[model samples]
Target: MNFLNLEIYLDYIKDNGYRCTPQRSSILSYFIGQKNRFVTAKSVTDHLQNKMGNVSSDTVYRNLHLFKDIGIIDLTFQDGESLFHLKNEINTHEYKFICTECGNTTDLNLCPMEKMDTALNDYLIYDHKFEVYGVCPSCL
Candidate 1:
C-alpha cells in the first residue's frame, strides 16, 4: 500500500470529529507498514514497545477496535486468534479462507452476502465475517 493511504485514514478520523493522537497515528502507521497481512494486537504492541519504548496492550486493542469501527481495518478469527488486516479498496467485499496452521489467507473474490436468505435482506447490515479455516498445502 502507498504511504499516501495514511493521509486517507487521517482525513477519516478528522471527519469523524476525532484528533489524531500520537498513539493513534503510530498504530495506523504500524498497520500501514504491514501492508496487506493479518496481524495480532500483541504483535503491534511489541513493535511499539521496541520502537517507542512504552505502550500498553489495552491501548493497542482500543485503537485497533476504533480503526475497525471506522472502516479502516477488518478482523477475522483463525485458530482461536483474532487477526486484523487492512481493508483493500479494490476488494472491500471479498472474504478469505484462512489457514489454521500457517495463518495464510486466500481471498475469495465473491461476496458471501449473495448466499444469505432472500427474506433477510429487508434490514440493515453493518458488517459480516466469513472465513474457512483449515490446513494450508504446506502444512498438510
Candidate 2:
C-alpha cells in the first residue's frame, strides 16, 4: 500500500487499531517526504522536534518500531544504527545488495530461497529477509 498521502496513512493507522495522533501523522509525513531512502532514527527525532516542538526520542523510537511491525516501514542496520524507509509495496518480496561504505542499496533479481527449497522442505517459512553487504563499485 502506498502511504504517500497523510490521510491514507492516518486511516491505515486507525484501521489497524492505532490512534491517529499528530506525532504519528507527522512521523509518517516525514518518511513520505523522504521517499524510499533510509534514514536514521535520530534524524527522524530531530525532524519531529524541529517541526512539532519537544517530541521525545523514546516516543519516536516506539512509534518507529510499531510502524515496522505493521509493515508500513522497512528496517536495516548501518554502522550499528537502525535505518528505516517506507515500504513501497506491502506484499512484494525483494532482496538487495547493500553498500557498507555509503549505505546504498541495489535490488537483486534472484531469490536465494528458490535454491534452498529442498533444505527448507521440513520448515514452514512464513517470511524472510535477504541482504548482501559489501562496498559498492563506486566506493571500491
Candidate 3:
C-alpha cells in the first residue's frame, strides 16, 4: 500500500465525527509511517511521549480502538498483546501469517472461509479474519 498523507487521515477522522487533534494526528502519522507493519499500543504511547510529551497508554489505546472501529486500522493479537496496522484496503478480507516474536507479517494466499463455505451455507457470514501466528524465520 502507498503511504497516505496526514490530511487524508485527518479528513477521515473528521468525517467520522471525531476531532482532529494534534495528538491524534501524530498517532495517525506514526501509523502512516509504519505503512503495512503492525505496532503495539505501548510503542505508540512511547513514540507520542517523545513527540508530544507524556502521552498516556490509555489515551493511545482509546484512539487505537476508535481508529479500528472506524475502519481506519486493522487489529490482531500476538500472545496477549494487541497489534494494529493501517488498513491497506477498506472492506477487503486479509489473511496473514504473523510472527509472534517480531510482529512481522506476510500475506497468506489461502482463505479458509472458501473451504468452509459448504458448512456455513445455512449461515450468513459478513466478515472474517484469519491469522496464523508463530515465530518468523528471522526470529528463529
Name the candidate that leads on TM-score: 3
Q: What order do candidates take by lDDT, descending?
A: 3, 2, 1
Model 1, 1-140: lDDT tens digits are 33327778887888878889888888878877775668988888998888788899998898888878777778876658788876665225547777777666677777668777465678877767777777779889
Using lDDT, give the best candidate's number. 3
lDDT of 3 by residue, 5-60 (tens): 77877888899899998889999889878756789898899999999998888899
For model 1, name the residue pairs that clash. none
Candidate 3 TM-score, true structure as reference? 0.83
Each model's TM-score, in the order given?
A: 0.78, 0.81, 0.83
Which residue pairs in candidate 3 have backbone atoms (N, alpha carbon, C) closer than 3 angstroms, thus clashing? none
Backbone clashes in candidate 2 total 0
lDDT of each: 0.76, 0.81, 0.83
Give the CA lDDT, 0 to 100, for residue 137 in model 2.
99
Ranking 2 against 3 by lDDT, winner: 3
- Full-model lDDT, candidate 2: 0.81
